[model samples]
Target chain A: MNQARRGRPRDAQVDERVLRTAAGLLLERGYNGLSIDEVAERAGVAKTTLYRRWPTKDHLAVAVVARLQDDDGIDDTGDIRRDLTDYMEKIADALNRMRSAGRTAGRDDRSAGVVAELVAAGARHDDIGEMGRQVYARRNALALGLIERARLRGELRADLDAAVLLDQLAGALYYRVLVTGAPVDRAYAERLVAAALDGAMNRKEIPPCP
Target chain B: MNQARRGRPRDAQVDERVLRTAAGLLLERGYNGLSIDEVAERAGVAKTTLYRRWPTKDHLAVAVVARLQDDDGIDDTGDIRRDLTDYMEKIADALNRMRSAGRTAGRDDRSAGVVAELVAAGARHDDIGEMGRQVYARRNALALGLIERARLRGELRADLDAAVLLDQLAGALYYRVLVTGAPVDRAYAERLVAAALDGAMNRKEIPPCP
Candidate 1:
């Protein structure tokens, strides 16, 4: 039970410094190379302080990634297609960045790299898994809100499954990175949004799903 | 490289016996509990023989899951929606089964379980990752073929991006299991297929994306 306790009084500056130092080491050295002792030394913090905060390397790694995801805020431009595409691109860019961590700089590696370890970290620790779900739940709520607003504006169907739609848009990027080893980018995001918004069925005289 | 070379002579009976024994241990013992020595001993095969075949515990685990996936044959019932729903259910069923591994029976655990380790296994080894991609490639080709048949029959758009469609369908399931800790089942699959087939956009006068 190495979960970080909520509402623990802490120095904001120290927290930020530790995270910055940890993130740099993670990206520069990969997950296997990340060491708590090294991070403490580099950040000029006591080892006990970092351990008390993060507990384990997995916890530290998940925190580093959770912070990155928090910055990818969704934008609303009234156009569902365009807005969704922009959001998907932000996610893809983040995934690509994480996928590049710990690999040879110019090798063009297709592996999930640190991204896979983050997912595994969730599986390994129940608290990390809960934290990850919480992180995504917050982000998903925003995306769902965007979809709900569009539905209200008559831009989408009245019965649109916003959750499933979000899953499709975000899921495809993860599927490519984690499962299929495929590339995800702006062009792919456009194609994914188009397929999801317009659908595959021939719309000529085809009635929508009941 | 820990890769099982292609065209290498293998005893079909021994492979099946070893895989069945290994699968039992994996489901009962979980990923961390799985050991190569124990598998070789329990399967009554020489340690050298098992090592020559699987090379590592991760390879053995991947092989076990790959065999399970091989049984999920896609049935082209001609209705793309119905067929896709059925295919998705099979995937969800497999995911659920793996999600329950190494946990108390009927405990309703939301973690990804062995599935997460399998994904990490691929990330840890390039050979396993390539093997995983090949497995998905074969299965995806069949699903893509099903989508292609619908498109050819005027049931879907002529310019449908089959690959993205498949990604959306399968990706959502994996995303629920791996990222969100959300439940994936038959009912959700129905909603997913419906959303993917018909789309979220209001279709009265909206032109499809070019």
Candidate 2:
């Protein structure tokens, strides 16, 4: 990290320091409170330089997400079930971290406004859309692989669509995080995955009971 | 609607015009763009009067939501699947209307920043966080009742946590509307409800290969 920071003396395209400072403030002050002058002052750069690259707060907001999302690479484990559990639990952890961070940044000031900013940022895609897609796709692919492997082993039903099923379970987490701001721990992840995979599945095609 | 449009008597403590005009403008300018003076001018009321009633723009935003929400109600089909599907589809429809309205106001920005502000108003309530919770609880309880009814009919697992299951499916709509800005229709709602109720649900209990 230090090496990367020191070695970036040549380029002046997008201000990495400004981006980092802005992200920190955003995670702290939230979307409504962020300003170009604060970011430039924090990064020791001119406001003109910041504005030249990012015309609007929306554009800079996207850039901050893009920079932070670089860490969202795919993780593969040989055991699909364990891997899936860990992957989902990690998502919960990430959410907890973000929520806590936002809280520290005064998100509690007005109906989780800071977190709402993050949600809005996640809403649309400029350049960061691809990054967000990649992160979610990796998650989906992991679930798909687990279900496929289970199917091959005669575990899951042949007809189950892992893609859609994965969404059913994962979408639950999104709700929990966004609405309730609840804890996304391993225990919760395991239960949800197990329920989604075993308990609720009805391959016998039972009728809609009256 | 026409009768109420008639001119009000002089010296009315509450200038209804300001509130009405602000609400109309909210759907037009969104939360981020609408201002206090504009609302006053539109309503032809004193700016001081507007401030006296709603201390902040956030407060007015909440009032606006309360008004609109009063105009909306849930669908009670008595069938769990159909009812939930209809309810979710209605939510998606509302989101669509809000999106269209936002576009009309913002020209290019299709966000419910206005709505989000209103939702934020319910973030913390001394009594019970009554604002957003009442809205969500009512919606949740309605769905939970449907799921419980299904369970009582022996259609779903006796041990199924219906609340979590509902969250799993409904969360998809919220995520789509809140994050992806995607159009969720009856088809999507049906698919989600089906998956939660009768699709592959167990992840840990691997079926033994014959």
Candidate 3:
């Protein structure tokens, strides 16, 4: 019920100022520290002006996260292996840029803050949770495309669901973010691709499609 | 050296009180919000006395986590597969406990605060960041024992490294946790045991060791 209504009229410059400031505070102090007052102050605007557009902190944060730059599309090189490699590298590159952006611009905390609360909010999007699935859905779409191509080429199991494979791949990245401080670097990316492409069996043969 | 030195006689009872209070605080507020004053108050002891034992918050938190009890040694029925199932089941039980515990005790900003800090500290303890790895190590140790038996029975490839196999088995669990939020339940544990026992590649035809 507290979701911010979109499309409030504003000075383009002022709207841009508010967004950039909110994004900055998210990275700096995280969700608990972010406030409407701070966003208004950072934007050098009136509190009434900020409240006129957004209804809740969750809505504001989600909007900011929704606006984050993510991988638009995977570059397909035709060769399956090379395409996967390129895809991983691009994803890895995006991940690194996000990390660095988090560190320098005080943005990472806000990004993660939104993710944690949204996910914890479960299906309750009204209370600061609408943005939870956007990033994950984007990842599944990209990876499913890769796996679907591989399945067509007879490189993977016909029975293996693209959804499952995508889950395994994205899951590793989320796991790294949550539990391990491990970087999603090119090498690790390559290893994950290898594990997905070829099961961790020591045998050189790929599993015959079921 | 801000490290506290108990200049007098070392009392094991005092150390026990310190650990118990620290553990309670850790489970409640986590590392960041947990303070020396609170721990002492909960333990019904003086702050100076708690300080004399812990010295720093990081040191105190580590000690508290380290002291928490772990499982009874695994039940190995001499079959690696069954042994792994039971072992992972124990782990699943623990994770279920933590998931609930994390949620119920989810007050205090420590969800991000403590987990982030402690995971980053990456300090070597038998129990800290080793949360996921410990369960794997125990399972792998059982698998190594199983693989050797399988080799004698002519069921395992000669070139297989037990350590690598163990990593993949556990890596699968980590993958699931990261992606699907799937519990390492009885079913998942069985799948892991099977995949590890029989290669993900149709093991009936038996791919040769690479």
Candidate 4:
């Protein structure tokens, strides 16, 4: 109640400080090292305040990621290939950042780290799972819209399944990071977009009418 | 040493019994309920014997999944569409099985279940991660060979990136099951294969020669 009485300005400041401190700690020490008490102390906020907002480390971690993802806005330049490639590269950058979190420079670590923990957190709790899915839904909706626009404009086939195409483009990045332990970079993103758009089936030329 | 002296017959029996019991427990209670002690006791094997085979529950779970995946053999009927669709369906079936593991029948539970646990297990341990990657590599290699054969026969474009094509196909299924909480099925598998094999670009017919 007293915190509420302190009002909007103070509350915003507290949230900003807490999240910044938590994000730094997470990137430095990974998921296991992100202690709420330490974050509260560093942020100059009470433990009660942090817990009242985030509830658990998983919540705090998810919040941190939500903030990071919020900055990834898709732009539609009317060119589906370039647009999709840009979008995929953005995703790859975010994944690469999280993948390299808490690890030393110049050292090779193939561990999924905080990314795996975040997925596990969603699977472990129903509310978190719902929240994570909502995040994906919101982000994916934008990409889906972009694809639909391209399809309508005759850039893509009229019969195209936009959702599946988006899934293929985004899924490849996630698969490399989560499953195959493969590297996802701009080069890979370009290749993925090309393969998906051009497709695998060879086209046969129709005979000219005499 | 004594067990080795007991010969191949007893060793095969022990492995079969242990895996069967583990799979049963896993399906009934999910990942958390699977304990090595219980599996060993139910299988009538020494705890040491179980440990010697699978060092941890994660190892046992991975082994169980490996057994499940082993039955997914790709058939090359020279028709890439049918083969790819069949392969995607098999993957969907496997994903659905793990997705439903430890949940009540007909109950709506979006939890990824044992599949999530297996992915986390791979992330947690290097050896487990390597083994999981190897499993994926082997399975994908078979599918790649199928795609390559189709390409050579002019069924597909000669310049198609088989790896990227495979990634899109398999990655979409995993993405749906693990991230979006979507239900993957045979129908969805067919759509996915169609979208992948057929390019998304709008086709423009060449003008007839005068």
TM-score of chain B of each: 0.90, 0.66, 0.61, 0.91
DockQ of each: 0.54, 0.30, 0.13, 0.70
Q: On residues A88-184, what C-alpha lDDT tens digit does candidate 1 reach at each position?
A: 9999999888888878845456688888998999988899998999999989989999999999999999989899999999999999999999999
Q: List the residue pairs that clash in candidate 1.
A: none
List TM-scores for all candidates, in order: 0.92, 0.71, 0.59, 0.93
Model 1: fraction of native contacts: 0.82
TM-score of chain A of 4: 0.91
Fnat, model by model in order, equals 0.82, 0.34, 0.05, 0.70
Model 1 stretches astray by more than 4 angstroms: A1-10, A105-107, A205-210, B1-10, B105-107, B205-210
Higher-scoring candidate on DockQ, 1 or 2:
1
lDDT scores for all predictions? 0.89, 0.61, 0.54, 0.86
Mark the regions of model 3 whose C-alpha exceeds 4 Å error after superposition: A1-63, A69-71, A75-87, A98-130, A161-164, A202-210, B1-17, B20-45, B51-62, B69-88, B102-184, B191-210
Candidate 3 lDDT, tens digit per residue, B9-108?
3466677788887877776654456788888888888888878766667667656644553333566455556766776676555444333332443322
Cα deviation of B18 in candidate 2 (Å)? 8.6
Q: Which pairs of residues collide in model 4?
A: none
Model 3's chain A TM-score stands at: 0.64
Instruction: Count clashing pairs, candidate 1.
Output: 0
DockQ rank order: 4, 1, 2, 3
On residues A1-210, what C-alpha lDDT tens digit does candidate 4 reach at each position?
A: 355666687777788788889999998888888999999999889999999999999899988887778779999999999999999999999888887787664335666667777888888887787888888998999999999999999999998998899888888888887888888889999999999999889888687577
